[model samples]
Target chain A: MTGINTPSARHRRRTGRLDWIWFVPFFGFTLLFLVIPTIGLIIGSLTGGHPRVTLKYLAQLSQPQFLDAYRTSIALSAATALGAGLVGILLAWAAIGGGLPKALRPLLMTFSGVASNFAGIPLAFAFTASLGPVGMITVLLQQATGYNLYHHGFSLFNFWGLAITYLYFQIPLMVLLITPALETLGRWSEAAASLGASRWQYWTRVALPILRIPLAGALLVLFGNSFGAYATAYALTSGMINLIPILIGQEMTGNVLFSPGLGDALAVGMVVVMSVVFGLYLLMNRKGGRWAQ
Target chain B: MRPARGSSWLVVLLGAAYFILPLVATLQFSLQTGTRPLFSAYSSILTASGFWASLGLSLFMALAAVAIGLLLIIPAAYWAYLRAPKVRTWVEFLSILPFVVPPIVLVFGMVGLYGNGFGPLSSPMVLILAAYGVISMPYLFRSIDNGLRSVDLRTLTQAALSLGAGWPVILLRIVLPNLRTAILGGAFLVFALIMGEYAISSMLGFNTFGVYMLLTGQTRAHAAAALALISFALVWVFVGFMHAVNRGNITFGPGAR
Candidate 1:
């Protein structure tokens, strides 16, 4: 499997003209379920009570309410991505840099795998149980220090609370991403140290420069992950938060205030945002892949 | 040149506290059902009318998706490994394209392409099951490819061919047994995902476990907490099993290549 990519006739067999037939199931499945639906969504978003394509609903996206949703969604995603990305790098660095006990690395990694997969409604419940009104930590903090979090404007339904909830999975995802990237930087640090570079200097000149691309790439992924997430924010706030996914949900499920194509337009906008973010991620990864190797 | 133990321990401790405290708090919250029988929420949830139905549906969907995904992916991956490398790249990219189109958007597209409620396919379950197969492709392909990397498929196939063994024999008898770990690993990952999935299920008006959890969470806090713990337990069990079976070598979710 490793060396199969080489074009050597001796290494790879290009025989079996009918070999492509096996992939038809996959092609048909993707086309029917994934590709066709996305195309339908884009066309639906463009349709404006005419045979010709129009951007009337797309123009509706500039309305203050819709604009607010996009802003909140993007801000939440960016904040959580940067917040989790920083802390994840810290944890991954600690575990992989040989500063922790040997057993701790695998434990950390296994936990990372678990936590990253741990998202959606259950996560919202967990955070609410921890920090919601009358939650354990809320009650405990008020009892121990008499500091009412809610009185201090720390409601879990607000933007910051949602950010914290998002960080739970986002951080683990960042750890999973940056750990292997961290593993590749040990040699560079050692070389810098051998040149009598101080720890700070080694980090500043050698480690950070090489890591910048992968770090940015990882952050981009974290951003995209948070952006598309609907369940966590929806479950946590229940419409208190005006994020894009929840808004899209309302538009789709709306019976009374149903705008003609607003939901489809919003959905299309989300896909466009995600595409641009991932496109940059691919570019960063291509350049960063060279350094990591 | 030594790693900084003090800072490392500091970061690890802070991180551990942040991660573990929520679970602890969630457990405490689940148990704080005042003036009620001990764990009545859990008991009542078990006896709840829609609980089993929703959970059972999600479970069935997960199993079906895993089976269908394996059937489609194993052959495609094997064929690509033997014959075409370029096609493998295209298929793999398409697998992860679900990432860009969030579940809400995908369902929106489906509604637009098909009818709103019930349309061409007769049942929304069929479309959803197929979508699950497509969405599970990224992890499925990677994991099966990971297994394919470990064994010499070319040599095994050649040896089997020399013995007059057929393709079915080679795939089912030899390849299947050898790739059990990878297959189970990917299956568990998909199982964990589909069981907890909320977006696609809710958008389609399906009464999945995730949708059920949301409804319960809104009405009954105690029961919701109990259900939340159960959901977490389910995920932990499935993911832990995958990790243990793969000996912690398998990674869940896509991360670089």
Candidate 2:
């Protein structure tokens, strides 16, 4: 059956005309919006008012506040990724390990899907409405135990509070990305286990090697996703919390020190952070693609 | 080798409880109707003009953004998949650039470029551009790429060409039908995103659904809760619709891509 169909007869020859017409609108929109805005941001960072090129804006990175913001952002991103990824892997293992009932699989999957995509300001509102001073849970807890979490400094405006809120979405995203990888493991692992292999040995010898690359790649994507996030933190703390995205926003809005050049330089810093993360993601993805093949 | 089922149920229950706790609280707050410090905020927000206008504006913006996104993405994606596969990654990366860039940064950039006498900063059109361009990236790129992966574009083009069908006809008749489910799923996801987006709209001086919640929360806390409830419900519905479409596609196997 395979020998009957050959590539020689039906394949059409290339015209080599290089169809340029189709690319015009696509490239035009990309260049105008994305390329131009980014360039403007970069140039804006390089020069202050009146458009004279200078390096004064770049030197603002030496400021303590900017440095603190950068450190906090990196730390938060790393912690979130690590926590979410580990939990996600565990959840995937449980769900796809034949440990859960058949009927519950779909329900769990749907819930995880919704929760994974569920973040940003609404999530913040949800958490605050439940845990704030006048919040429902807060009121209930106080009435029952004469103890208010808020009075004990459980404010959602702080760094730890923000991290908890961020986890509302991060955990689910990790589960969603990792579940498919688990599903692909199928009955092979079980068959190996039945053949006298211990659980740890089976996973180490078979599954871990196969899944490590994709897991690493997913972790990179999650790290980048949290690192670049702005809305959730912005809405929760009103940009009071010193995060890079918040600082960038403050600078852009002229709320900070009035230096368009400095704001642009801060934006350049943001671009640099995103580029490094994205570069890591691309590298991991390339490795993952090879592994998948 | 079978594990006990009760542990699984416990895990599922714990997960559900964690996910639903905040939502249940929000709903309770939204439903309160008293006038004192705790209760009357919901009723007031429900009767407010700003609430209604913001809701309408948010819906309008979301719909417009989705429509514009579809129009732009369909053609661009089709062209990339069919003619210039080499540039596909770069094009996709560009499309999602706004998303990867901080929202505040993008909003500030927009203000710098178009605010004041230069152009329309506070205009709804600018919000639409930002929302559509940023949020639509994942949807457009994923759906279109999946659709392309599912079919043989070269063979379809050749077959259509031999039968005297033009490029437009082939695209509309042959390509689109296969991509319908993916497009629908993507659109729904984009719609949900725009519905929840707050930073861009709020920063740019527009009153989106999220902004309504923030604004109302300042004075009428319950009203803010009500707004949050409404926003949550809307997003829930959109997510449900996306899941349904995806499930249906999976069942038939036509939309698996």
Q: State the C-alpha RMSD over the true interface residues for candidate 1, after superposing those residues.
A: 4.1
Best by lDDT: 1
- Structure candidate 1, residue pairs in collision: none
Quote fnat for model 2.
0.34
- Give a tens-digit lDDT track for model 1, residues A93-118: 98888467899988887787778878
State the iRMSD of every prediction, in order shown: 4.1, 6.1
lDDT of each residue in B138-192, candidate 1, tens digit only: 7788888888888877677766766667667878988899889999888888888
Superposed Cα deviation of residue B253, candidate 2 (Å): 25
User: Which candidate has the highest DockQ of all?
Assistant: 1
**Per-model TM-score on C-alpha atoms:** 0.92, 0.88
For residue A95, give model 2's deviation from the true position in Å.
2.7
Tens digits of per-residue lDDT for model 2, B1-257: 32246655565566667678888998887766664655466567767888788878877877776676666666777767766787676667766565456556666665665565645544646644754565566566676667667777667866776776765787799888877777777777777777777767766667777777776666766677766667767767776777787662221000000
Tens-digit per-residue lDDT, A192-220, candidate 2:
77788786777787778878877887787
